[model samples]
Target: MKKMMITALSVVMAFSLAACGTKSAPDSAAPQTGGATPAPDKKEVTLKVGATAAPHAEILNSIKAKLKEQGVNLEVKEFTDYVQPNVQVFEKQLDANFFQHTPYLEQFNKDKSMNLVTVTGVHIEPFGGYSQKIKKIDELKDGATVAIPSDPSNGGRALALLEKNNLIKLKEGVGVKGTVRDVLENKKNLKFKELEAAMLPRTLGEVDLALINTNYALEAKLVPTKDALFIESNDSPYVNILVSRPDNKDSEAMQKLAKALTSEDVKKFIDEKYKGAVVPAFK
Candidate 1:
């Protein structure tokens, strides 16, 4: 009886020890409620924007690190031409674009029937008159071919620059809408050759002088403030803007992007990097 009782006790002890030796599952390994995973540590917002290559893309690239700290991811798509950015934005492919000024945006909307609007003015890339053949505007020979942008808005801007420099006289009240037909007086008798804005830089040796947009000038390794014979004034109305769809104008992402663009750091970057070729338009 005693041996049977001891055998039963030994059997019970062995079973308990075996059970204790078998490791139980860890608390962390336990199944979560409804089999759902926990949320991520950080929430991220992404904003994709279209911009021109030089200063616009460069500026956006500079702020990427800063935006990341705010849990905002900035994706900048470089565009060579001015048209596609707006098209992409209107089609909802891009969240915003940072290449055009208000005048260009307005004209684009009117012409294309798009609903894009400016979120904020970021920078001003003054149009410049670059020439390899002449050192000064007055040095041009009679009937010297001057290249200007073929786009109506930019063409008018070119005319305005000419009128500002007294090389030509535009019709009264033509202002930003001036065209070749609006030329009232051509004192220099300078012939105007209209080409795509991006091609103006390549035509420097071809034309006596080319009215080059500052962005393209930078891309072609020409500094508007230093290389151009003449440049637009600082107070010029052609300030480059950040544009968004009307519905997204007040979104958090747009606001954050606008803030990042107009931040003092960006202003400093523009001042240091562009060296007056691109000026911060924000106050």
Candidate 2:
């Protein structure tokens, strides 16, 4: 009876030791729910904008840090041609674009049947005429080839500039709306070559004179203030603008970008960097 009792006691002790030897699950293995819940981090908004290489991208790059501080990350995509920027914005691939003026935007909207509105006016890249073949405007010979932007608005702008310089005369009151067909008087009997705005800079040697936008001229290393045979006045009506769809035009991020673009810092940067090549449209 004593041996049986001892055997029972031994059995109970062995069971206890076996249980202890089998390690239990760790506390870390359980899902924690009792402690305070951690707050989620605020997400940063990304604002993608398309721009021309020179002043547009350069200007946008200047204010990146300021936009970032406001929880908006600015991504500037550089474009060589004018059409894709507007196309990308209209297709919702980009948040906005900053290369064209109000007139061009209006014409683009009308032509494409797309409604991209201007957020704010940033600066005026005065349209100018450049030539590698001539040193002066008067040096352009009769029947000289003059290359201009193919688009209606800019073609008109270039024609108007030519008219303003007395190289040609458009129909009365045609003004900036005139096309090559409106040239009523051609004192030089100049031939008109309409090319893409981006290509004009490269055609300097090919054409007697290529009317180039300031942005392209700058990209090609041509200094507008010094190199342009003739340039539009600073008060010209063409003001390059920030453009977006009506839906997102007034968003917080877009507004912040617009504000930063027209800020005093940007004004100073334009003044010091572009000299008289680019003029700030904002007061």
Q: How many residue pairs in model 2 have overlapping backbones? A: 0
TM-score of 1: 0.89
Q: What is the lDDT of residue 27 in candidate 2?
A: 50
TM-score of every candidate: 0.89, 0.87
- Tens digit per residue, CA lDDT, model 1, 71-151: 889999999898999999999999999988888898889999988998999999999999999898789888889999998
Overall lDDT per candidate, in order of appearance:
0.91, 0.94
List runs of model 2 lying over 4 Å from the truth. Answer: 1-41
